[model samples]
Target: SQELEQSPQSLIVQEGKNLTINCTSSKTLYGLYWYKQKYGEGLIFLMMLQKGGEEKSHEKITAKLDEKKQQSSLHITASQPSHAGIYLCGADMSPNDMRFGAGTRLTVKP
Candidate 1:
């Protein structure tokens, strides 16, 4: 089984600043998914990467997969209070094996 690890377990940024979160996997990733969730709320799917060196962006958030397919980065531009939440990176190591990082908690100061 594979496991995902996220860096900077937590972050606090002043409003309008930019931040980046990294996710690394112990095994090759077949598929990588990013999700965001607020306290006590359900996870909200943000992006998915299937190919090596692939990237995707939605609004002010961007996600990228490294060429090795074992690492991913999520960049947030112009951080806002609305962006405060826990970000999770999930990976499918095999058809039946899936794992998720502990999640990175972000806080935006006004």
Candidate 2:
């Protein structure tokens, strides 16, 4: 699916493993937003970028925006069990639009 579908709806890895999740869209993304949320908890703001081909990262996670803006990727390095959570990438259909994928549920084993 090109409508912002993420792979491995869920992932399980060891405490210090590395992982990557992808987001694909049918059309170019004018705006991209990534959010991290713990189960039953609120989503903590991660990053948002408007310029195509732009990328931003925080802590152990990195997010990139494609020049075509049709795809994006999020990679986590040296994952810690505490890093387990849901990662969601969204595209703006309108200034107020925020469509999200089902999400990539990450589980880091201790």
Candidate 3:
């Protein structure tokens, strides 16, 4: 089993600004998934990575897996208030095993 550590446990950014959140793994990562959760809402699947150096983007948000497969980063461009939420990183250790980080709370100021 591997442990996931999400940096900046919380963040505050002005609207239209850019920000980044990082996730580190205690062991080599085989599969990684990024999710966002709004206040009092379920998690929304953002992106998934299975190969090293893989990158994915949706609208203003982008996610990437490092070449070493031990880290991943999520970047939000021209962030907005709508981006305020808790960002979670999950690692798929096996078919039946998955672990998640404590989650990063984002606050986008107007």
Could you estimate the TM-score for every candidate?
0.95, 0.90, 0.94
Question: Which digits, one per residue and each the tens of the lDDT, describe model 2 over residues 34-71?
Answer: 88898678898788878888888898888888888877
lDDT of every model, 2 decimals = 0.94, 0.84, 0.92
The clash count for each model shown is 0, 0, 0
Higher lDDT: candidate 2 or 3?
A: 3
The parts of candidate 3 lying over 4 Å away from their true place are none
Best by lDDT: 1
Q: Which ten residues in a row have the lowest lDDT in candidate 3?
A: 1-10
At residue 106, candidate 3 shows an lDDT of 98
Residue-by-residue lDDT tens digits, candidate 1, 44-64: 999999999999999999999
lDDT of 1 at 45: 97
> In model 2, what is the error at residue 93, expressed in angstroms?
2.2
- Candidate 1's displacement at residue 84, Å, is 0.3
From the highest TM-score down, the ranking of the candidates is 1, 3, 2
lDDT, residue 80, candidate 3 = 93
* Lowest lDDT 10-residue stretch of candidate 2: 93-102
Please, what are the lDDT tens digits per residue for candidate 3 over residues 22-91? 9998677879999999867899999999899999999999999999888999999999999999999999
